[model samples]
Target: MTTDTIITARGLTKTFTVRKAVVEAVTDLDLDVQRGELVAFLGPNGAGKSTSLRMLTTLLPPTSGTATVVGHDIARDPAGVRRRIGYIGQGTSAGHNQRVRDELLSQGAFYGMGRRAAATRADELLESLDLAPLATRKVLGLSGGQKRRLDIALGLIHSPELLFLDEPSTGLDPQSRANLWQHILDLRREHGTTIFVTTHFLEEADLFAERVLVMDHGRMIADDTAGNLKTTLAGDVITLGFASEADARAAAARAGGTAAGSSLSLTVDHGELVLPRLLRELDSVTSATLRQPTLDDVFLALTGRSLREDAATSKEEINA
Candidate 1:
């Protein structure tokens, strides 16, 4: 592993035997995560996102391949890797009957912190995550958002250099999601913590992360910035409406676009530049509109499916 790389994995693979059938959870994966980078890992259900995170966090060993996290080999030195990383899974970590402050303090103590130091760190985290007012409240009495906040506090009690968050904002309301994101950003800004997160929320990944890693069917499909993926994979969609169907067909023929009834649609890399040139050439254009490609568009272009739909379907299957 390089000095700046906090995580390095090569040829990683994991498989499970389920009811006499084999399931490949991750396959021949290679990855590197640099220090202080806030990266989002995105995929559908059973797409290896969580599997990869578990391998990297030393929670689950890969069946084959090698990985080094925080300068320690994942298989050979899991304790070393664990000491330098904090993992907050999908569910809350605090005990239901414990006070929020006491839970945090207990976490610090588990890391071998002195009573005074644990109390100090507990108070600091409560204030930072906006859980100070509810510090004395029992964990079971707290709302969903508050419980998640306490989970984060529990993960950070030891101030690990790297943090792994699995569906951190999965069940939060929009307002609570906003608040959680703010606190997460604040943690990165103040502590330079390397954050590796898995989320189903497309907009959250698009707006918050510096880089995105997309996976499908146990394999990594794409790795790049959200803007780059949208620009390169699924360019801007340009739609032009004409007064007559014949005019739309003519415009489509001239612009190499697809025509449907009275509208011509074409995708171009730079809509701003293409729109002006197109309008000048096509005199019969009655209306023109440009729609910028989003991260979902990139996914659709790559896999012929939508991540949003996958998430909804996954939820439905779980309920069923």
Candidate 2:
């Protein structure tokens, strides 16, 4: 690992033996996370995102390969990794019965902090996370957003340099999600904290994450800044209307539609199908609209399915 590298994984693979067969959560993975980078793990549900995160955090042992997180080997330096990183999972962990401020102070005490320091840190986090006004209320009595803020504060109580958040905005409302991301950005900017976060929201990755890693079916499909990925698209997806598929193809051919079929149409990878390009290529074309490609478009192009379908699939599955 290099000096500036904070997390390094080599051929990481994970599998579970539920009964007679093996379920591979992650397969032959390699990852390099530089210090202080907010890397977003972008994938559909059960795409080994949470599993990979859990393994790296030393919460679960990997089936194969090695990782060094925060300059410590995962296999041999689990304790060191634990000491250097803070993990906030999907479920709410703080006791619902206890007052929020008390819970934060107790977490600090668990980290061996003095009472005065713990109190000070609790108050500081309360203010930072917008929890100061509700500091004395029991977590159960708090709203979903407030509890989530409390959870984040608890995770940061020890001031760990690396923070792992798994679906931080999973069930949050739009306003709460916005609040959570604001604090996340602030944490990274103010403290230079390295963040490794996983989320199913493509918009979240597009807007907030410094780098987006697109994963599908347990394999990485695309990894880059969202803009570059859009630029890489085939020269504008041209959807044209015609009396028939052949007419559409004929029109597309005039406008660089090498693979045009029917009104469905086609274009180069990450191509910008703008009004200018359309007008230059196909004057015969009648109505056309320009649309900016999104991370969802990237996901669909790679996974062959919309993200909504993936989310809906996991939600609709019946229990065993």
| 1-320: candidate 1 lDDT, tens digit per residue | 22399889999999888778878889999999999999999888778888888899888889999999989999999989888899998888999999999898888888888999999999999988889999899999999999999999999999999999998998899999999999899999988999999987889889999899988888999999999999999999999999999999888888988999999999899898999999999999999999999888988998999988897786521100
Query: How many Å off is the CA of 212 in candidate 1?
Result: 0.5
RMSD of each: 2.4, 3.3
The 10-residue segment of model 2 with minimum total lDDT is 311-320
- The digit string of per-residue lDDT tens for model 2 on 1-320 reads 22398889998888877677777778877898898889999888888888888889998898899999988998997988988889998889699799999999889988789999999999999998889999888888988988899989999999998999998999999999999999999998888899999999988998998788887766677788877776674234556555566666777556654433455455555445355665576655655544567887777777788877787787521111
Q: What is the TM-score of each candidate against the true structure?
A: 0.95, 0.88
Q: Where's the lowest-lDDT run of ten residues in candidate 1? A: 311-320
Error (Å) of candidate 1 at residue 125 is 1.0
Q: Show model 2 residue runs off by greater than 4 Å.
A: 1-3, 233-235, 240-253, 258-274, 280-285, 315-320
